[model samples]
Target: MQAEIEKLIVKFLNRTISNEEEALLEKWLANPVNEHVFHDYVQVHYAISMDCIDDLRLEQSKDRLILPEIEKVRSLDHNVKPKGFSIKPYLKYAAVLLVVGGGILLLLSKANEMENPVEVVSESEVIIAPGTDRAILTLEDGSQINLENDSIYEADGVKASRAMITYNATKGKISSEVQYNYLTIPRGGQFYVELADGTKVWLNSESQLKYPKNFILGETRKVELVYGEAYFDVSPSTEHQGSRFKVVNEDREIEVLGTKFNVKAYKDDINALTTLEEGLVRLDVDDEEFVIKPGQQVDVNKLTHEASVKYVDVASEVAWKDGVFSFKGKPLKEIMKTLSRWYDVNVVFEDKSLETVRFNGVIRKDKKLEDVLGIMKSRKINTYRIENKTIILN
Candidate 1:
């Protein structure tokens, strides 16, 4: 009976199920036990289809799907018992059909009913791809080098790989003068950098970081986040002769006590946020001092300088550095702003009330813009249409 049902499911997925076969499948589905068998077959099929994907094909394929824990169990052996499956994290909207490329995935609406799946096609000719590793490196001499290509650039004590650049630590007595280098991550791009002091920094899209090529010994190691977001993992004070690290901007500065943290201080944003993941940080906003601990975030109003500290999920705060977009009770407006920065596109809300609609989920950054929009539609957040680089929501 399971084998017969599996054949029926294949026919259904291929959209070639005859009326009699469809009736038999629906009858078998009424048993409830048969549903699990159906899901297992579908999952195995999905996993097999997406196995061994190369980087180039994965990037070019618009249907780069992630089944969360399902990707781990991709075997064709029938004797292997499929573990329990729950689609809460990735697919809470289980009833929604996932239409990607030339494939249509129909999910059961209820235990007893199956809705006819329809392919949701985009009206646009071109799909907006996700961001990549790219940035502009501004040398101390004011010369800029684009880091978008696959070539390696090494010169003047600095070495740049495909997506990251590193500055070698000076061996002898350091110069009193500090030659500053700037790394600017434009829209739809991100980059990593290792400072001479061994501190690591991850610059997000539409962000910039300015740091010295070499740190003067016995002095306070300082770097400036001219504008935008950055995650810092500072080298310990003990590692650098007890020297403290400071990340500064025009209106705010973070004194790092040899720890890890993330800062969001976009130019157009009204509030500057600093979320600590590990260790401690002292923030100065408009001259008012505030000390932040791990698992806490300090939000300072850029205009009024009013500061508020609260406990938050540090993983969601710094998820971008890990190549995932994790949102927890985040408003649609704020989420759109984040997406705008990474995808390098503008979003228009026809209904302003939709901005306040909150959502909680995790999405990989590698997914295409349309896939995200489809998820938003599944959540009943809003109806959307993409026009060139702009996304219109109603």
Candidate 2:
């Protein structure tokens, strides 16, 4: 019975099966047991299709269809469906019928269409490169500092706590002789620095970092971010006193006793995002307060005062800290924004239609503007010329 079914399947797939054989095959497949066998055959046929084994003549001329060998099984005590039944015959037959039907459909659909195929080439080439020479730092003394280079400066030093240089001065107390420094990251540029208190900071482009030259012990340890993005791996105060870490962006305040987290507060973005990588954090806005745990993020809309907590992809969120641009189905505008900061170039849209395009890929920071733009073009996005360091995208 199985051999007869196989022969019928082959003939059906070749579109040469008699009406009787087609009816028999369909009837056998209508049974649940036969359907199970038919499913296995379909899997094998799918594998062959993926391999592009579509030579109909070769398949039709084949004298033998080898079935996969099954290992010996223990005896069944009850009447059960036979194991290792082959359905390859049914799938081959189905494939042939589907292909023929599809071809017919295509022919009918294109009956009124032109025969010539049109080739499209994009005409625009506007590439948004990353930015450089951006970021400003504000100091505790109400003084603002712009950091574009790797420079070590002196600050008022107090006692050391949790490997962080504790500052001795109050927020309002600025001794004429005591120097405090703030670091600012301009749009399109990022910087890394170690404060006197041993706190490591990675400032994103167009962001700012404010800390004392040296943290004064017994005084609350705080840093202010004017804009942009940053990641902090704060050190705990000695004896587990837990240093106070606060990040102020616009009207939003993120206070943490000691935790590792990332904050993105770009001016162009609608909301400020704080993702906790480890430990805990208390997010305060206006009079509302929310506690964030590890693997959670708080999104605060600076304009609407709306806040929500959500789970996020930690690796993708912190990829910028590792000097790579990783985008997962992000629109072209958002991607261009990141490139604009990294390459320090303005992005102008020449073809507004392409702005809605989304892409999924990883771009290394070391890639040149032309190389990156070429990739976009391959995806049907064109870039125009750069006008005065501005990338015109078409």
Candidate 3:
């Protein structure tokens, strides 16, 4: 399967793939990570002959491709807007380079499948793949259901369909009863849910949300993210005759009228955050409360109960919902924390000082562990070891 897929990718690069092969290739690249893998093969192969692999700098001048890696970059928090970096131009430059070969493009064949341009070096050798759509749903009766199972099951009146579960909000007015359902996304897993109030949530890996089976009329539609992260597209308040929407995550509470937001409230983390992408939201943390506008994120310190509001790139907070991992100058520790949850691996720092090393890159969340690490290695922040489920940084 890997050979055929690689062959199809090669044919895609050479522009010689048949119609059927083109369909298959598109199906594979449909996953954003495969697109990274496609570029991975190209860049690694290109670096073989070029001495400027480590210090690669990409310059797009007159549709010409200039392959280079920038060695130095400052640390950016996960929510930091990449002020001066643009990846779209870089990718376009590479795409153009592969087609208009500069006389050294060796598009790999089926035989090259056995030999990867980048190597994976790990101790005890655990090949951890990326996260997928897998989660467990707990109903009000405490009955558990694995969403991954391929069966049509209805729990608490909500129907589960493969990767998505829907609650028909428009069917009629919600009853006064409040029966909560828990959607638990384990490590290396994710799931999507459509609430009875018409709000849609994309739960990231290792997250859990407790929401009422129905949003009662004339009352607030409320949900609680027990832990981890979730992106919510809330239904309009006018649809329910002025009913508001509220989210409770530990010490913080988010009240929204009709808005879209992203929340990350991990159990082990010291802070809870809510990033508003659209509309408006009011945040309540301890004794303080504030109205957050669009493009703004609120971070509430758990210990001090201090809530800080700042504008951010909404894309950074919601990138996982779009099938990509977008980082801008994020420190090693922060990045590893995000990766650990999605990849279900422990990130250990042998020398704690290395945790401050910052990286700026956009990667696909669906890529295999090694390829994802290889991308990091390409950035020169490449000291690490994989022993079973733990990734140790030296």
lDDT of 3 by residue, 30-99 (tens): 6667767765754443331232222222332121323222121212232554443333333333343332
Candidate 1 lDDT over 223-262, as tens digits, reads 9999999999899998877889999977788898699899
Off by more than 4 A, model 1:
1-124
lDDT of 2 at 313: 52
Candidate 2: tens digits of C-alpha lDDT, residues 32-74: 7787666554333222222122222222222122111100011
lDDT of 3 at 367: 64
Residue-level lDDT for 213 in candidate 1: 90
2 against 3, candidate with superior lDDT: 3
- Model 2 alpha-carbon drift over 4 Å, by segment: 1-179, 238-240
Report the alpha-carbon TM-score of model 1 versus the true structure: 0.71
